[model samples]
Target: MKALLILLISAIITWTLALWKTTRVTSATELSSLGFGWPLQWIEQDQSRFQWASYPQDARLTFVKFDQLPAYVDWGLFAANVLIIACALLVIYFSFPLILRMFRK
Candidate 1:
């Protein structure tokens, strides 16, 4: 149970850090009109620049399209979180009976 608790706490901390990093990076970046859902006329008027100046890179003049960008989710972090939860649940479930037996004796 102690080990499981430690594992869960570590997983939570790692996930929180990763999430914070993602949010910070995203907040610092910008998206262009290349893949925005706005109308063509609006895009032509340059209204689709979302947080264009917040990022170090200038996405406005980039030739790359938004759809070609990689996904944001970290599968490894998600898998670690799921594994930690499962281990914590298993530890609690198995330890409960042992604890009750000790109390009964």
Candidate 2:
């Protein structure tokens, strides 16, 4: 039961953080910046034509036609985050007994 609760909590936290970070991405650059050290230039989009290049570029400029990022990328990041957080939590929970024993000595 405790392990299940831990997993549930980890999933919730991971999903919340993922949504929060994902919403902030307005451009390819912002998306690439999500999760520590995500690959630079992860998306390959065509550059604006020379005639239109002189205009000021905004977030939509990077997106071009896409309204949102690829679903697979978002899911992959979420899964990775959940795995990392759950592993960290399990390590701490399991080693807690050893830590307590050392302190009692």
Candidate 3:
């Protein structure tokens, strides 16, 4: 029972750390707004002459680009939330048995 409790605590900590790390990663790369109006207008006005000049070209690209969060980070956050919930459930399940036994005695 003690071991199970320890496992549950460890799992909870691991899950929490994973979620925190994921959140930090998201906060670091998230873009406030995408300056896309010019690009879109250019495309509509003249498809052949359309150029992505307004876009940040000089910024160093990351492996996980903030501008592309909807494509990647959103789903990652959803999955992490699910995993955190699952870990919480496991902690409850493992601890419940011991709790019940203590009450029975």
Candidate 4:
């Protein structure tokens, strides 16, 4: 039950962060390189993004680009993320008793 709760909390957190970052899309269109890491990931727009016009008559819409697709659907990355989170939770679960013992007078 603790692991499940931890997983839910982690998912909520990452989802919140993803939404926050995505709310403000980067204006820079030039992709210098991939920035895949624990903190952030910069996959190619070509890999998981598509160009779409927000308005039919807007001139700037012609160059539309999305930096990320939804994370939930991306199974490979999502699974890896879940695995990392589960491991972290397991560590916490195992060490929690030790921590409580240390706190006792």
Q: Using lDDT, give the best candidate's number.
A: 2
TM-score versus the correct structure, for each prediction: 0.34, 0.46, 0.32, 0.44
TM-score of 3: 0.32
Write model 4 residue lDDT over 8-91, tens digit each, in one string.
876665544443442223423322222332334322223124333442211111123554332223546655666676677778
**Ten residues in a row with the worst lDDT in model 1?**
36-45
C-alpha lDDT values of all predictions: 0.43, 0.49, 0.38, 0.45
Tell me how many residue pairs clash in candidate 3: 0
Residue pairs that clash (backbone atoms under 3 angstroms), model 2: none
Pairs that clash in candidate 4:
none
* Deviation in Å, model 1, residue 92 alpha carbon: 0.7
lDDT of 3 by residue, 16-35 (tens): 44333311112212233211
Candidate 3: where are CA atoms >4 Å away? 1-73
Backbone clashes in each candidate structure, one number apiece? 0, 0, 0, 0
Candidate 1 residue lDDT tens string, 1-105 = 866676677566544543333211233323322221111111111224345445444333222365443333445545655565556667877999999999999
Write model 2 residue lDDT over 14-88, tens digit each, in one string: 655543332233444443333321221122223323123232323221333665433223555555666677888
Ranked candidates (TM-score, high to low): 2, 4, 1, 3
Of candidates 4 and 2, the better by lDDT: 2
Decide which is better by TM-score, 1 or 2: 2
